[model samples]
Target: MKVKYWTCHSDGCAANVHIDKNDHFIKSHGQHHHIPEPEQIELRNLKGKVKERVITETSSITKIYEEELARSNLSSTALTLAFTAAEG
Candidate 1:
């Protein structure tokens, strides 16, 4: 199919931003080299929220495992094997 687009001129970038005759900006077709300031701040905030959730979940899992180990009679080797199998 014949497609119409504009090539970005930034170094090491291969962006093909679409250009419609009636519109100044449409859709882009590559990894964006730069994000606008507002978008950058929003992305950073999202990253922070994700990191926080990961840390919280990891801590909770660790606490549960520690409690289970303390309360159960399973040997360390058995626990290790069980975890290894679960991982796979």
Candidate 2:
């Protein structure tokens, strides 16, 4: 059976998520060593949305960014983090 591995993002984390071809969860291994960061998660999702739009649209990065930011409804903390990352 074809499967995909979704590994943990935290440093030194050994956790992993396995999914089958149909995107059904097969099983998980190990465990996360840190608590979930909701704000960071929101920022990651926002980046993903922008990336998908960038791939499918001819719009300028600035325009796409503005549009996505408007629709994202991210928390203030997430917004601050996003802008800080962009500046770096």
Report the Cα RMSD per candidate: 16.1, 1.3
lDDT (10s digit) by residue, model 2, range 6-30: 9988889999999999999999999
By summed lDDT, which 10 consecutive residues of candidate 1 come out lowest?
Answer: 36-45
Off by over 4 Å in 1: 1-4, 24-26, 34-88
Go through the candidates in order and give each one's C-alpha lDDT: 0.55, 0.91
TM-score of 2: 0.87
How many residue pairs collide in each prediction? Answer: 0, 0
- Residue-by-residue lDDT tens digits, candidate 1, 2-69: 34687655567787777567656767888758653343343344445545655667666545555554
Q: For model 2, name the residue pairs that clash.
A: none
Model 2: weakest 10-residue lDDT segment is 79-88
lDDT of 1 at 13: 73
